[model samples]
Target chain A: MKLIDRARMKSPWVLHYNSGSCNGCDIEIFACMTPMYDLERFGIVNVGNPKHADVLLVTGPVTYRGARVLRNLYEQMPSPKAVVAVGTCACSGGVFRNCYNCIGGVDKVIPVDVYVPGCAAKPEAIIEGVLMAVERMSEHTPLKRGK
Target chain B: MAVKTILPFGPQHPVLPEPIQLRITLEDENIGQVLPALGYVHRGIEKAGENNDYPLNVFLVERICGICSATHGLAYCLAVERLLGIEPPPRANYLRVVWAELHRLHSHLLWWGLLADAFGFESLFMQIWRVREMVMDVLEKTAGNRVIISVNAIGGVRRDLSEEQISEMLHTLEECEKQLYALLPVMLNDYTVKKRTAGKGVLTSEQALRLGVVGPTLRASGVAQDLRMTGYAAYGELGFEPIVEQGGDCYARAVVRARECFQTIELVRRALQQLPDGDILTKPRGNPNGKAIVRVEAPRGELMYFVVGNGTKNLERMRVRTPTLANVPALLEMLPGAEFADIPVITLSIDPCISCTER
Candidate 1:
């Protein structure tokens, strides 16, 4: 493993985006950051800017409008990026699957490296998903320099 | 002459957990006009509810807002009950109050933490959420889920609280109260918090009433109005009063919610003491054949569920008016004449739940 890859494994900055979810999963994500679940112990930081983020943590099924924004956020993140879809809604649209505005699941808009499924995914599950995404990040080949 | 600049905030921003776009027209640093663009989180759950059976709609409505899931489920059940001409057992009513108050306690703590984070108080945010986890544990032990506790059914609750669980809940509440009280000074009198919040976004009582604001936003502006006082579910049996503050600023809203957390804890204790022993569910004899309007006090404010039943398994229409929507206009009213830096703080003060608004 490269020195940079080892460093990245120790600390993975995350960017959270709520596509079109009920706030259940969103709050659970926040809970994961609290002292008890402390995703930060794994060297994770929730960054607001997409450019600075290494892992794109998305919650909720993609809504018609949210899909466009989700795609934009995913594209903005620098490569070696991993997307983790949190909650059942982001996995398979959950209950809002048949809703008119919902397009269903984060994968419908972008590739999700880790899928955490729960009505509102628990904090522990979210931490596990982030770890999985970091593993995916290590395996992913960095984008060609001049591409 | 001050230069005018348009600053776009959110759809995705650090201070907000949900997505909401604010197109702020600013003159120098002061906001001249603010236009909020929503629907970023719109899932059309109301439309989805129309196609589902009344029994199944409980889950649909509950997902409308995860923080206030219990109240949403209770409101839908109340509307459906009115349509079916049946009421849940008295014990169920008391149980609903217990869960609803627990929801309020956790939600207010969540908001308190977020508001602290908005002001850049990271340690306070962590401490508040640490205390909030106790309430979440209580909810999980009683309702079987943490955030979206699927406890409510169309007729009554799906599960009942055991004696051990109730005692454990009381002990936990005592711990929470101690922890919360310890932080009261930080929330109320911290110089940085007060400087950022007090007199920053002033919404006069008249302006609040005119804008049709509901919940703590309205109450903080000196309006003594809360749907909980109407005694929906088991509120009437309990001595309930609205928490009102006259400051009409971000600090007032914070104080209102802070005090409400203690109020809710007291309510849960009273509910447990008064809980009657009986069946939690009363099966509805037939499909709902009429239209009914049910309003319940969500953690945010008044949450109204209008169910139109056509004497079938499916509902004709299910309309939800969440408190966040009602408070938006009031938010627009509060924005102009405020500093641009204060926008996020004022926005969070309303506890803007865009998911609940757009849904």
Candidate 2:
């Protein structure tokens, strides 16, 4: 079980979803994977489909239409998954909190395990976010293994 | 018997950060037609600007679109400054140029990463973004905020760069240019990338002009037009002809941007060397009463701002003409003949920011 936990911590494949964001955080999040910050050294890969993903990196202030898409995608991911809400918009609705279209922060639609806050959080912060999410995921699974 | 097939490209597609829906009419995976429906994240920020005081409106406008936030703030300040007849210090003008080009680099690096993702060149996406981070770090160090630098004000910018800071920024940008230049050839001449992009979504010089595509899109189509040439800010002091490419395809657009990235680094370094000394801002004496139209080059394209201040605290009306919105009709024209699998890749060529457009 510890081995599974370690492997998940080491090689968590991510599926990023934007609930409707300004491109600031979205671009910063991508910057995390670029050559300088290179998250691949941690063995993280951004997979296209949610079903094969282990972590969900969400950005933006979830809008009304985005809420439906978010739930549909969240449901598609297999079990044993964690959601990391990146950027201020995803965490507390940021500047768009009172906008006509926003449906509040991501937590309104799904359970979020970790929150990284910034108008657009930096790449360094996003890397820290993925690691923190894995730590929280470990505490949730029970200690005893069934025979 | 015919069945209407539906495919949802994004709210989470690799090529874009904002949620945009394109319902494609497909005949067995061959795209028969495409329809785009935006307004997913419309914040009604334009209306918000009308309510907020002039000072507060500056902050609100910066959130209009994250990628072009600084430019939005710049255009708004310019419009308001014109109304008040305040010429910021000479140093402020040069400082604005430095930050604006830096913003251009960050924004273009972002667009480059998305372009790589659209083509499924994930590693390249990562590579470009890594370089992009250095520019953001520069922004943070200088402006004290990463995305919304909030550097520009109606009178002038708030922060000033010391000689040491200026030298450090110059050094940092030099390294970035070297690293980015090393990667440009592969992105331009790589076999697979060219095969995918070269002829796809061909917009000839004439077609681009007809559609009124601005910025790199127009430049790629061989139009020698750039609002920067209009001598706004200190651009006239550091002169260069427009970067033009003849092909007008996805490949040409990519070339135009790659070249501009290098040019921007040159511009920033030059501005630093020629950095003038003076006051940053001067308080305006009277109320703003007239409407004004201010145009500037945003990272994506030509960004124009229209503001009508009614001699009071609030603006009578405010309008933003975003580049993505102007280029949409052009993108719609490019989509019809493209292969079904290339829809996302081709659509992304315009660097769509639905939030910016819908605002």
Chain A TM-score of candidate 1 vs. true chain A: 0.93
Error of 2 at B339 (Å): 1.2
lDDT, candidate 1, B1-359, per-residue tens: 99999988988898888889999998999999899898899998988999988899888888998988988999999999999999899998999899989999999999999999998999999999999999999998888899899888877888998899999999999999999999999889999999999998899999998889999999999999999889888899899989999999999999999999999999999999999999999988889888899888899999998989998899999999999999999889889999988988999999998888998
Across A43-72, the per-residue lDDT of candidate 2 in tens digits comes to: 998887888888999988888888888898
The numbered model that scores best in lDDT is 1
- Best candidate per TM-score, number? 1
lDDT of 2 by residue, B283-347 (tens): 76677889899999998899999999899988999999999888987888888767788887778
Candidate 1 collision pairs: B231-B236
Query: Lowest-lDDT window of 10 residues in candidate 1 chain B?
Result: B149-158
